[model samples]
Target chain A: MKIRTLALATAAGVALATALPVAASAQDAIYVPLFTYRTGAFAGSGIPIANGMSDYLNMLNERDGGIGGVKLLIEECETGYDTKKGVECYEQVKGKNPVITSPYSTGITLQLIPKAAVDKIPMLSMAYGLSASADGNIFPWIFNPPATYWDGASVFIKHVADKEGGLDKLKGKKIGLIHLDAPFGKEPITLLEKLAKDYGFELKLYPVAAAEMQNQSALWLGVRRDRPDWIYLQGWGAMNPTAVKEAAKVNFPMEKLVGVWWAGGDDDARAGADQAKGYKSLSFHAAGAEFPVIKDIQKFVVEKGKSQVDKAKVGENLYNRGVYNSMLIAEAIRNAQKITGKKAVTGEDVRRGMESLEISEARLKELGMEGFAAPVKISCSDHNGHHKVYVASWDGQKWTKGSDWMEPMKDKVRPLLEEAAKDYADKNAGWPKRTEACDKAS
Target chain B: MDILYKIFIDPFMQMGAAPDLLVQALWEGLVGGVLYALIALGFVLIFKASGVFNFAQGIMMVFAALTLVGLYEWMARHGVPAPAAIALVLTIGVMYVLAVSIEKFVLRPLVNQPDIILFMATFGLTFVLVGLGELIFGGEPKQMITEQLWLPKGSIDMKILGGLVSLQKIDIAAAVIASAMVAGLAVFFQSTRIGRALRAVADDHQAALSVGISLNQIWVIVWFTAGIVALATGIMWGARSDVSFALEIIALKALPVLILGGFTSIPGAIVGGLIIGVGEKLGEFYWGPLLGGGIESWLAYFIALAFLLFRPQGLFGEKIIERI
Candidate 1:
């Protein structure tokens, strides 16, 4: 009986191993791995993004038969928003030879920065990684497109200045920054401090520990006592709603408070409900599913029940943000196909594609995303376009565009970005200089 | 002279100038303390009875809250009548089932295990509950059923010391409810047959068994009682923010309370919670600026460490006189 059982187990193991690879190799597809957190504290913010990223790529497969006739094999590895788990996920998924990696957390992105070049895999951090990575001339493998955190801060200061009639009026006015006490949250401090000195405004920082994200009564008490004229919040996940609620508790004017894009989820605003009305946050992409591309996603992915997203939330802000992210992926793949003249391209090919990537107004309209986001034009020297972003305000229920597209202060931001990039290389001994050539196509 | 003035004199001067802010901070601290005390109350109940450091208490709080919200949403979606009340009752029933299962599956087989073994088991239990809760509730933060439960909304602003101080109505309700629950638990422990049996078990396992008390029954009851406390803490805290796994981190704050208060004393939990909460708030409000403003996270632990150095057994922990 023991001999028979051992032979049966061996046979089953052999059969399983033989069947798995056949299924994996059945289609020649471009592998894309998303380091996502579907469980843990950050899941509230992460779920929609995961759903959005997966759904868009899946929709492409379903509706368009994948980008440029090659299927995109999208896979997700749960990280729970921990940097250690993120690295483990990267190691686990690296063996698959993925065309690109998108580790959504800034912490994860920072960890993968030194590894991406060694592994020859390009990382897309979207709008949330190291601001200095925007200078592709220094850091070639990492990409944080559209706008960097410093760009967001510059625009935020610009918005506050605009609200006060002019930048000259900002002198002596107190500006408080309520940020999560993490690298991502602190990314904007230097830029804001620079702008503060330039504008002659008083800058005060209120850092919230990650553990104490939900508890901010003392922080809000400080806000109440200091009575800063403007408050900028760089909070994420559970911190945003609690901050909004606590700000209301102290009778702080909701209109005077602004948040970064990460803090502007529907759930974040809805937590405060009517009390959060007039609360504003910055956004590069448009909200709502009125766009034609979103309609296609609904038609192909959500309606067919292939999506993990709530059917009602098909066109929400973060979901659309995901669509935009995947759009970048799809566009990069298409550009790579055009550049390398190969239906299937490697990560190096994708890097070159990203360098030369251009999303003109006409191209956006052609892709059924007209007016959805600013026109993006990436080149060899600049990975991030430093694109303009608008402020979206909560009107007791949903978000509405509250301001015109405001450009980031690139004139001031560029010099600082170069200096920081140079400083970053200086800090790390033997940091490899960018060896990749500037593509003339870019 | 400047450093000394900044440390001692500046904070007091600021407090004197903004007396209303001081009052506001005090009220906030008190409310926060009450909630922390409630969480510590769960730990004290289980520790006093089972002598196991139940590291799973925090996840249990998140699980209980998730169960309540998940059940309510399920009921409402299925068109159940009075979904909120029915869901609350069902959640209580679920907690009872959880208590029994934990006692049967986790504790029954390990009846004679070492305290360290049982503590490690709870560490394992924490992960089990986290995975289970995530599987069931899908890990998204849900808004508490505050409107459905008829919890008070909005705040009341009062003029005092020539300025306005705002107090949230829900916080007031939480304070009152916490006090009533603590009082009820006190009465139960001090004046009931089963509660006496529980105390007997807490005193000595063999002695209680010899006196016709069942350790198994006592554990189930104590765990169930702790479950109810967890539910209350979950609701009040969730109403303040939203129901999510993130609330699990706040439960770690109770560890310092347990350290400052005795592991076995109920009143110590409340007093310790108040001290930590109020102390951290005042520290953060007055002195946090000098330290760059995120001191509330570590201030409670620091306060507990100070107490550990001065009173090793805690404010109300029984003195352990071991014979060599």
Candidate 2:
């Protein structure tokens, strides 16, 4: 009787041990902390991105039962587009073990990068962040998935060259850059300067004061006086349409004006669509209704009456692009879960997953977004995996692809990137050391 | 000589070259000026009736706009039709009841205090309104209830001397509404009993008190009317851009407008608004190059400053002879 009792006790202990893993797995939720600005000057962009992020998470739960059966939980903290507030939010939410954070503002991303390494959290900046973060080995915690500003500048210059027949034909031509007087606007300058030197073109710089972009008489006067052959706008908010309108006021050819991706949106065109006809902008992904992903969003999100925006805004350029951004982040999280057998993934796990991600053609096609973006293959050396970009032009109503995907001139950009990164590191003093491989390359 | 050219000759030359652009700039300035006047009108109404410069007028604009949008959104969420949803939004009129209570409880006891103290109290009220508005409405910029309100859209494009001068349909509506409101206010002050009481209070508080007019009652009526004016300005301006805290800054623009148009004169506010509007627009268009553009920001203030140098009492402000 004593032997039988001891054997039953051992079996009960085994049963308890087996149930522990199940309980642990059951409580596992992939927490994604969102730093958003729902109130501020830039809320127009921030609101949509926040809604898209939340809606996609909801879609994951409803459609696929979350990533690998571990439900995704998102906690939002409003940043009001302020960097200091963003840091505070980061500190507050970092304890939750967020897999990754996407602070949509470049200013916020810059502030959070140091904290990212300290907290062991990954920051996934799809497009807006430090350009030098393209060297993922140096910035292991930061991941710029698709492209960088350097890549954007090169693509823009290439488009201009192609328009003028060839790169050699760019010599003796003047390309003016009208940018906001902020870090966000200054991103492409070093790259463009290098490109101008290599391609033998004159580069003119025009800076617009922040919050005062609506008024641009002096800038246009400069435009009229200088007569630059091409205008590249690195502007945001009201600056885009204001520039277009001012250009029209000065009788400058609208076809010659180009803007960065930030300026390419429905609202930007809405104000001065007729005058802004033929205004080209650099885009990393497909713009307009051609993408199947857009159709699916309109069907699944808008048609089902689950959208945060009006049905009319569903297929709009910026709104749909926001949806694509949500899908990308979701895909990265899923990929991370698959690699790490743990049902609950941590920030470090997400970082590894982001570096090793390969969004191939088949995956895109399955997700109904085939040909919308180039196949992104991120690695330790390259954080901005796909440096492919196309030029889209506004034809009064909608955006149309004006050129095929073009690669930036890396030969011109690499040295500049290294210099800027070294300068930044020297100033900061406590920045993480770059790997020997990057050092050797530099 | 170059400085003289930059200050005067160059600006005129540019204006001559870009007459069309100048006209467009003037049009934008005029619209901005009118909005500023609307905000100033709210301030003047309360100041006239209660002798208190309500600093909370800006937040009132934001609060009214937010309430309108929040109510509409809530109605939509409940599957209410657009027309009924709008009617539901009009129920934000209930805020006036709260306003009246605050006057009775908060301000009535502190009556006869110095104007500066009263101003500080209103400043406190500003913060309270901001906090309460954000707490209730979630501190986000919501689309204005323009469609439900049935406001006009697009602009009327006119050609003048080979130049296109486009004015928004809503701007015209704003001008008309503002004119009618001012006219109604003038007639009220000249014709109505309560309006005369308000004017008497503005003229002399103690003397008006001796005439058996209940100052508290006059204050309530004035505050409510000011709230209505704020709501009107909020809707008009919100329809233009959006309903958010950013609209609050629109009220600050009225400070310069108040300075240019005498604080006491209603017609001065209107004419001053138009002058500042037209002047700043033309200044930005023609003279902006000399100052690196964006002159509209400082143009009105500088104009007011220069005008004050010439006419210290403002365009129609009564001169007060100091005994000191």
Candidate 3:
């Protein structure tokens, strides 16, 4: 009889924990689920972003007493950069009424795309995801806020054209692409091929095997042989620096080399700084000690001893960018609450808010993130609100802006986005029909 | 005739046009070869003494480096300065004690088992270490305490032929330390009494036992020595990149080295590592474009496979005489 009583009590406790929260009205609290990889091969990049995401949530709580007086609760589940683990984390956390998920990985985002539609939860991949998800009409659930890989590539090529003084100047030049052999690295291929056809530039492709980033002797040797006028590097982790070192060995001028944002970070620069002088790359967010968001982070998170990782890496580029990622989510939640008059909004409500987000300059200034990113306005037709990107060059020590913001050729990109998204929808049946909020009226 | 000239002769002619580039490629290949040799040496030591391939060697390299960083962090958390943190890291060598205990408890009884069984057991051990490592020390990559360890940063550029050849200070240090360690290991095995016992046991375990040499003592000593080599390699490689699981795959490069060098010969490992390293570098330079580059991935394995056709027993391994 005593044993029966203990078992009954344990069941009652679990029931109470689940039932007690739903009893409260929508204004009680706002819970956001965070999926991150704080351990494994990619932890060098993951830890900083996870820390920044958590700190921004904490800042919202401390500064504003919560969004609309509803406290923010964040649950962090470790994925270790494994796609299977990331899916498991999503399933475990979806029950908590998480309005949106920022997976911070392209591979994880790809796995969760089908689930996002089934669960009616918005998956906000700020920078990396299915590049085709930029077409909101097809991938209504997956939102890439600033830009996709295609946008990044086109913006980079535009910078090249401007540098050569005109698009015609690029007619006969050779351009080489050295990329990691993964979905993440293959993202810009279609757009690059299109650009190659239109601009009449010779395109050479080089593939780097996964986890073999540190030994890129052959890729650089090709650079020596073909001697491409410009080299585009799509790499991650140690591959970035290894490529830089090999290029140095082949006497490939760093100024002519361009890396994607993932390849252009403090870790990559630190590895081959002296040898990689004058290397240029794309930048979506601002870097260095100059940004106000960085200063606030140093004062609030680092000073209070609540740093997510080492205090020394508090203001690093990736860490601050992570903070920006979290801020974007938190603001979207606020916007949703304002429109719905429900402090604790549902996943559907958050999706609507994500569709209508307008991160204006004034909002950035208020959040102490001025100049970190341009105004990002999302709509149903375009999930990637910020198509603008700038080119930045590494000057041995730090990154400096090398060119003004350039936009991708939407006329060339939009058709490809639709085709890719349609193919994805065909493969996974039962995707929700997109709301025609931003479509041109017939 | 024209195709042959373009394929072989013209490239050599171009080498005259760009002798500096050829020399630079060779130098980079040499540095890569040295690091591979260091990893291969660690494998040879463990296999020679115990007759069990320690598949956990790579993770152990990562673990040892992580422990040093963890100790340094722990010291700093308690208000210790940088120099004191260095002293604290040295004390972190107790991980080897725990490692030796694991060998005694987990592996000692499994002795005399089939080689495949022993290999499977080591695979299980690798998983346990990977899990325990993450549990004890969080999974984030930590900067190797280079300043504390007094390793220099940056590289020295030298003009060779017509091109500029550059070598990192850390790579040079790694090459020098690896040579010294291998030399010391050779002397220890050849000149010391315990080393002779180790050799005797490696030759014939039952005979060594009959002659009064304790197999347990030799196994313990060899594992302990391997632990030291792992620690040294861990620090040097971690300083080059950050200490993380990504470095574990670099340890697998030693497998091809083992295949080429013979699993049982120390000298074979050194020579095999150098050959694979230099060959991959040269293949990447001259032949990579034909396949779109990034040939370093499978080049080492192919080289070892081709070499096996001629020297199936490995360069330095004793030929086995099997009775039909």
Candidate 4:
């Protein structure tokens, strides 16, 4: 009798705790649930990024009194970079009727893609996710703005092209792709392979198993033998630092090696110290906490001791990237409020706002993030704004800008994107078609 | 004909073409084997005394390393000289506390339990340690203080078989220290009084108990000893890569070593680890391309599986001379 009573009470308690967030939704607030990861294997990079997202939102509340008088309600559900936990967080927060869900993991973003359409929630995976999700027509509810992996891949090739003096010089150039043997790492392979064939370069592939990330002597040995002229690193977490260290050990030219944005972390390069100097990585936004918006965050959120961020490390690369991500979301919310003339907008309204987003230089100045990121303009058919990506080299101290904005091989990547998106839509069996809403938003 | 040649002859041709690469592969395998052997040694020590599989050994390694680094860094920040001493002491002290708590909270209550239950208990213990370690040390990967610990750094290049092979000085140090630890442990086990008692417990817990051996005491000692081994393994491996929970996954590589080297035999663990390590690297280097270049993920298990099919008892496992 006592056991039965205890069981009943426990179940009731769980139900109430689960339902509390759903019931506590405020009519005066725009709820944006951030499916953030502050722990687990990739927490080295995840913590700063998540803090940036949280701090920027908190900054708006303190500095601007929220977007258009409706206080922003940012809820973070820790995913620990796990897909199952990400989905669970999504289900738990979906009932709260969030304006958006920015799942920072590619795996979580992929899982939430179909659910976003069904749940009518816009899933924002900034710069990482299935590159095919960039086709806004099929994945109307999904948004990966600024650039996609395919776009990044093309941009890398173009940067290489400019460095080598001409595109034709890539002929017979041996380029090695050292990637994590996972879906996220494999995202750029198809585009890279096609480019290799077109450019007449020999593409040697090296896939690092997750467990073998730190123990990559064999792979680097192969790199030595193959002697790829350029190495494109597509790695994350412990893999990034280990790869940089291994490259250093093998006397691989750090300047000739470039990493994707995910691999270009301050901690990653710092792991190798002076040896990692001259290591290059792609960046969609300028790094560091020197922007005016960051000062506002320091003055308000961080200085007030409201945020979990270490105040000293506020202006780091991943943290700045996080600030850039929140800027995108906040601007979209403001856009949504203006479009619908509703301060407390729903997920669908925010989706529209994202579609109509045109982050111009004037708006950036107004936001106090003048050069944080490129001007991101989204449309109905194209989800990723596909902005120019620049190279940032870690010169032992900090990441310094290496190049002017290099345009992606859009002439090459766009056709592939359309075909892949179609393939994805067809493969999924009756993917949702773009409604008249898309035409109106554009 | 193309497929046959690619499978059978091509790898050998490549090996001939780059004998230096083969030597490099062998050296890498040898180093990895040593690390795996160290982790396997922890398993053997606990299993030999208590008959518990102890799935928490991997997490134990992470916790040990984290405690060492965390305290070391904290002390260094506070102007402590030779922080490595403080780090080592704190790590061992934490391990002792862990062993005591584990024995008191987990092992004691479940004493005389079935082996499977003890295995399951270790699984629970894995989660407990992971949560505790993360709570204490946050989940950031920290660089091992090689200079503080006086472990070697940088690399040395030597020409072998018409190619250059560069080895990190740290790895050479790891190999030397691991071999020394193994040799020292062998001497202790063979000669020590407590070692005799531990062996008696391994043979029969009931008999050992009847003969006046304190089961609880032996367990604590074995666990503490394993803790020291874990700390050593953590430092060595962390010197190669950053110390993080991710090392826990690499620790799983010790399982096949356990399989190949029998569960109870100390010598078996060392031999088995080397074999699996060498086998996996060779397979990944030569045959990996045929299987999408990631046979390292499963090749160790596959090698162990095939070996088990025929040997049943591992390479160094003793055949019972006469069944009671």
Best-to-worst order by TM-score is 1, 4, 3, 2
Per-residue error for B199 in candidate 3, Å, reads 3.1
Which of the two, 1 or 3, has more TM-score? Answer: 1
lDDT of every model, 2 decimals? 0.91, 0.75, 0.78, 0.87
Better of 1 and 2 by lDDT: 1
Candidate 1 lDDT by residue in tens digits, A1-442: 9999999999999999976753563348888888888888888898888888999899899988898999888889999998999999999878777888999999999999988888989889999989998889888888889999999999999999899999999999999999999998999999999999999999999999998999999999999888999999999889998999988888899999999999898989999978899999999988898999999989998889898888888888888888889999889888988998998788999998888899999999988899899899888889898999999999987889999999999998889998999898899888898899877553
| Candidate 2 chain A worst ten-residue window by lDDT | A433-442
Which candidate achieves the best TM-score against the true structure? 1
Docking class of 2: incorrect
Tens digit per residue, CA lDDT, model 4, B152-245: 7888989877888778798899889989988888777779999889989888888999999998898899899899999999998787778888
lDDT of 3 by residue, B205-227 (tens): 88899999998888878877877
Residue A362 displacement (Å), model 3: 2.1
Clashes of each: 0, 0, 2, 1
The deviation in Å at residue A284 for candidate 1 is 0.6
Q: List the residue pairs that clash in candidate 2.
A: none
Candidate 3 has an lDDT of 0.78
Instruction: Report the lDDT tens digits of candidate 2 across residue range A180-286.
Output: 87788888998888888888999988777654465454466557656899999898655666677677656788778888888887666555647778888888777
lDDT of 2 by residue, B73-123 (tens): 777789877743564347456557757976897689888888898899998
Q: Kindly provide the TM-score of model 4 when superposed on the true structure, using C-alpha atoms.
A: 0.96
Instruction: Count clashing pairs, candidate 3.
Output: 2
Chain B TM per candidate, please? Answer: 0.98, 0.93, 0.93, 0.96
